[model samples]
Target: MITVRCFAQIREILGCDTRELLPAHTPQCAADLLKVIAGARTADLPKPLLVAINCEHASLTSPVKDGDEVAFFPPVSGG
Candidate 1:
């Protein structure tokens, strides 16, 4: 299974903080996985969405597999 976590406003938009996807439902890369997770609400998500896989920063092209924890969140701005 792939563990997906949403944060900040994304959580509100998606109506959930966490989601679980079976390996059969997930794609090869993070980008495609995002699409599957976002579904028809892709445009509803914030821009420049950040991603982390297994607690480390990852790119959209990053390879993902079963048992990986994927997190999607908006950029953080702070002084």
Candidate 2:
């Protein structure tokens, strides 16, 4: 299983903080896994959210494995 977390506005939008995805096979990368999660929650999610793994910023191609913890959040803004 892969652990996925949603934070901030993303958490509010999705109405959940976390989920466990049982991939048929390990995903090749974080983005791929994101797609799976998005597909599962299509009714509640907006497009183009930011994602991270283990509290570090990550890109679409960031590799992921079973038991890895991934997080997603809306884009941050600052002055």
Candidate 3:
């Protein structure tokens, strides 16, 4: 299973902070994981998402492997 985590506004939007997706769900990449979580809310995402795989920033195209930890959230900006 792939561990998928939601943060900040993303957690609020998705109504959960973390979840596990199975391969049978077709979460082969970060993008696929997003599809699994977003589902009907795909178009409702507040902003572009930032993805991290196993604690390293990665692109949505990054492949997901078993036991990998994936995180999704919005871009952060600061002064």
TM per candidate: 0.86, 0.71, 0.87
lDDT for model 3, please. 0.87
Model 1, 1-79: lDDT tens digits are 8998988977888887888988765358887778877888989998888889999999788888999998888997769
* Candidate 1 Cα misplacement greater than 4 A, ranges: 25-27
Provide the clash count, candidate 2.
0
Top candidate by lDDT? 3
- Kindly list the per-residue Cα lDDT of model 3 for residues 1-79, writing each as its tens digit: 7899999888998898999877654448888889889899978887678999999999899999888999998997769
Comparing 1 and 2 by TM-score, which wins?
1
Please, what is the whole-model Cα lDDT of each candidate in the order they appear? 0.85, 0.77, 0.87
The best-first sequence of candidates by TM-score reads 3, 1, 2
